[model samples]
Structure formats: structure tokens, C-alpha cells
Target: MNPQALSPRAKRRRRLQQRQTVIYGLLIAGLAVAAAFAYLVFSGTVPSPWTRPITMPEKIETSETMECPPEGAYSVAFGSVKANVFNSSNQQGIAVSVAGTLREYGVTVAEVGNWPKFLRTDGQLQAGKAGIVAAYTLQQVFPTMQVMIDDREDASVDVILGHTYGEQSLIKSGDFPAGVEIVPPAECVPEEEPTEDELNDGGEDLVPEDEETEAPSDGEEDAEA
Candidate 1:
């Protein structure tokens, strides 16, 4: 126990033992730390890039819409319009009859109904700015038809047949404007962005109270005119 009396060899052995003890302690502590980290990773309390599941980046939503006539196009197909035919005359079933005739001429007749409030000598074609070109296209089906602008928001046009609306015989097959490009109506102002309105609304609009359309029964689809 007298340190001064201890041999030099003995002191050296004691120092070596102390060094070994320190090395073993450090090794055990390092192993404990590694074990804790592995437990945390397996329990999902800590994220490990190597062990995590592979995933794709989130998808971004786009606002692009599909329109029938398309945007900023100079011309449109004549009979490509969806028309709502209204009977402003005293004749019964005339609207339905005219709608069938329009369908035969390659126009998509949206609805057939009665609206006697129209007083124009020439049947009027009405739609929002988005449908102006479509309105003009329908006008060829009814040569004396007038194109009127409204506040609605789709490419659908309202064809209010006046008393002077022509008979079936007068609606010629040649009036289909077959393969002919339809220029925008004279009433459509250049500054008025019709095509853009169409895109913004995405070619969809609420129905008007006045439009009580009776669409023909098509087996392919069931939807409004």
C-alpha cells in the first residue's frame, strides 16, 4: 500500500490495467448508443433515409380546360353548335319539329320548348359572348335569324323562333354549311373575348328559368341541352 515502495514494473502494470478498463468502457458505451439509435429507427420515432419507403413527389393540379370551339380560333364549324330551339309561334310542336330538322342538318339540338315573348320578325339566336361564333353558325340553318348577346356563360345558344320562322321545306339541306368555316357574327365586337370566356367557364353554365327545354331522347347519353 506504500506507493513509494512499489516497484517501477508494478506501476507500469497498474497504468496498463487502467488504460484497458477505459478502452472497454468506451467500447460498451459506443455499442449502447448504436443500439438506441437502431431501436429509434425501427420504431419510426426517428427517420432514416436508407430504411424509409420510396415515394414519388406530389402531383400538381392544372387549370387548363377543354372547349368545343377552342380559344382564339378565327373560324368554327357551322353545325357544331348546341342549339336550344324555342317556339315563339302559335303552332304546336313546332319547336320540337324544328329541333329535329336542325339535328338532321348536323346541328346538336339541345332543347325544344315554347317562348312566345320574342317579337322579332326574324327568329333570334341568343347566347353569351362565349357562344357568339356558335350563334353565327346556327344562323346559317335559319338564314333570317338574328344573333343576340346575353350574360349567360356557356357555348350553348338559344334559338327563339319568331312567327316568321321558316317551314321544314324552306330549311334546305344546303344550309348545313357542310365543311364550310363559319366566321364570327357581325354583331360580335373584336374587343369582346368570346373564346376566353368559354375557357374560364369551362363550357359549363347554370340553366336559365326561361329555358324549359325538352331534349330528344338519345340512347347514348342523358344530359341537358
Candidate 2:
């Protein structure tokens, strides 16, 4: 194994083999590094370099507006005003009867029952600030009833019938504003009964076939001849 004892071709072959071994080692190391990088990508261990940014829309706020009548100017329809009729009197069925009458006059009656123990009156119309116009309209109907402002928070009026609420006839033509007139109940007309012929029809064909026709009588035959 002396350096000068080897042939030139053999030395050249030995050097080529060493170079090939180094090349194979480098290729194996590169493959191992590539496999490690692929594993990290699949397992989501590191954030991907290619990603997109997301944006969201902003929220908006809005307000609602309504036109109201001028101060002291009462303009409203009877049907738009919600009323509660309570029987304050000891007599029975007054609340129901009065509530029906009010409904006939196009008033929107929300509740009907006995009055609360604390309030007492012959007939009183109670309302809040929002129901002032409605209360005034009802006052025109019950002239003797008192209109009072209370803690009621909605656009509704409370009518408590008192001892003298015997006024059953609400047919009087009051000067109610347009679209607030008294709307009477529609007349119900009963359907006419079916006749005996209609009953015998039985909703089926009744004519005889030509092949099953009967012979004519002597007088009918002479007329035909």
C-alpha cells in the first residue's frame, strides 16, 4: 500500500469512488431535510407563508321619525285609539254592553272587565300624554264623563262606567271626524232553502238513452204523422 507502488489507473478509480460517496451523502442529507419540512407543513406546526388578510363590514345606526299634530290640535281617528272599558258600577253586564257600543262606533276597545278598587266615578276617561287626543275624542261621546291625566304610558284610554251609565243607545249621529263614523254591524241574510226538485236531482245524470227510449202514445204518434 505504498503511494508509489499503485498504478495510475487504480489511483484515479479510488479518487472517483471517494467523490461518489461524498455526493451520495449530500443527496441523503438534502432528502431528510425536505421530509422534515413537509411534515411541519402537514401538521400545521408553523404558519404558512402564503395567507390572505380578512376584512369585516362596519355597523350602522338609524332613527325613526313621525309627524305629530300641533299642540292643542286634536286630530285622530276613533279606530286608532285603544280604549279599555271597565264596569265601576255595582250593576252587572254594563261593561260588556258599553264596550260593544264603543266598538260599533269604531273605537278600538282593548280591555273589558271590572274597574280597579281605588278609582270611583260615574264615568271617567283616563289617559296619558300620548293619549290626550284620544281622550278628548271620547269626551265628545260621553259629555258628562270627566277626562283625567294619569300614569298610563301608552296611547290608550281607560273608561270606567259609573252608576248612571244606562245610556245604551250609541246610534246618535255625533260630529265625529271623517274616517271615525259609527260603523254598524253588517246585516246577515240567511241563504234560501233548496227546492224539492234540486233535492231529487241528487247531483247525477237523469236523462234516458236513445236506445232505451219508450214508444209514443197514439195521439202523439198521429200528431207526428
Candidate 3:
């Protein structure tokens, strides 16, 4: 059984044996890894123990917001314009009071719980992706009140103008208070080329030529002498 004396067939057999041993070892290792992964999947738990009771953030509740009407007595102006506004929507109970004019027809709507976003194309509050949380309850009720844009520097008074909620195209700038006007962003206009008349002629400026001083006539000088 000397190593040097082994035949070619024996050498080939020994090599094959070593290769099979390596393959068997790899196969066992693979099976063990698969088993471990399967266990993780079926355990019905996250890897982290702390994640077991998944925490959800607490939801914020809507609150009341107050805004004054554009005009009239301070006492009479504020309050819910519509009674049903409180009952129907998610709005929080809100009572408006006149704080005074903001700018022209603009008046401050103080104590707004939820910030109002202006929607020019439509008067109604646009539905937010997460849905709107109503923050103000109505003290007065008017289903067909107008919406108007407040010209005030502060954003508190940009109310919808014109027709009420139900009317088709109810919101119009014209419906706003007497002094309030909608100022849309200026649109780009095409630049016009200057006309030929506008160009300077013969080195003379577009401005009127200064009057040239005339040399006194020789005859007039002689007459004076």
C-alpha cells in the first residue's frame, strides 16, 4: 500500500473521494442556512423584539378657528354664517368676531385653529390628500354666502367671494367686498420690435434739436455802426 506504488486507477478514485466529501459538506451547509431562513419566516415576529407591539402615532384632533366678516358692525359681523356648518362637516366649533379692517375690505379672522389654504379656482376648501380636518364650528348659518379674496397684506382674510356653496361658478372676484379686488399674477406678454420712427436719424437724437445760434448779418452790424 505504498503511495508511490498506487496505480493510476487508485489515484483517480482517491481524487473522486475528496471531491465527493467537499460536495457533501457544501450541501449540508446550504440545507442548514435554508432551515434557519424558514424558521425566521414562520416565527410570526419581526427580527427586533421591540417591534412586536408596532407603535402608531397618535392622531391630532381638529380645533376651532375664528374669522371676521369683511364688513359691518364688529359684534354682528363675527359668528358662524351657517348653522348647519357645525353639524355636517368635521369642522371644529368656531365663532368669529370683528377685530377691525385688515386692508380695505380685508378683516382679520383671528383664532383660526386650522390654517386655511386659499383655492382661487374654486371657493371651497380643496380636499387634502389626508382629508381635511374641520377646525371651526359655525355660530351663524348662511348656505349661500359669498366668498371673496382679501387684499390685506396678511393672509387671514382671503375669503371666497360671490355665490355660496351650491351655485355653479358661485365664486367670483366681483362678489368680494367693495374695496377688495383679485390681483392675479401678471402674465408674460410678447415684446414688440421698435418701429422705424423710434430709431435715431442722421446722428440727431430722438429729442428735439437745440436751436443753432445764427451769426449776426454783416449788413445789420454795418447798419448799427
Best by lDDT: 1
* Candidates 2 and 3 compared by TM-score, better number: 2
When 2 and 3 are scored with lDDT, the better candidate is: 2
**Predicted structure with the largest TM-score when compared to the true one:** 1
In order of appearance, the predictions have TM-scores of: 0.46, 0.44, 0.21
Q: Please give, for residues 1-225, the per-residue lDDT of candidate 3 as tens digits.
A: 897898999999999999999999999999999788768867864263434654321232222222223222122222222111111122233212111221222332433222233223322221111211110111112223322222222222222321222333322223222222222212312223575566765555564457655668766664465
Taking the tens digit of each residue's C-alpha lDDT, what string does model 1 give over 6-108?
A: 8999999989999999999999999999999999999999998686554321222211221123234443564567878887777678778778877877678
Candidate 3 at 215: error in angstroms? Answer: 76
Query: Could you give candidate 2's per-residue lDDT for residues 8-50 as a string of tens digits?
Result: 9998998999999999999999999988987887799966676
Q: Residue 42 deviation, candidate 2, in Å?
A: 73
Task: Give the range where candidate 2 is weakest over 10 consecutive residues by summed lDDT.
Answer: 57-66
User: What is each predicted model's overall lDDT from 0 to 1?
Assistant: 0.66, 0.65, 0.32
Candidates ranked by TM-score: 1, 2, 3
Error of 1 at 45 (Å): 68
User: What lDDT is obtained when candidate 2 is compared to the true structure?
Assistant: 0.65
Candidate 2 wrong stretches, greater than 4 Å: 1-71, 118-120, 168-172, 178-225
Estimate the lDDT of model 1: 0.66
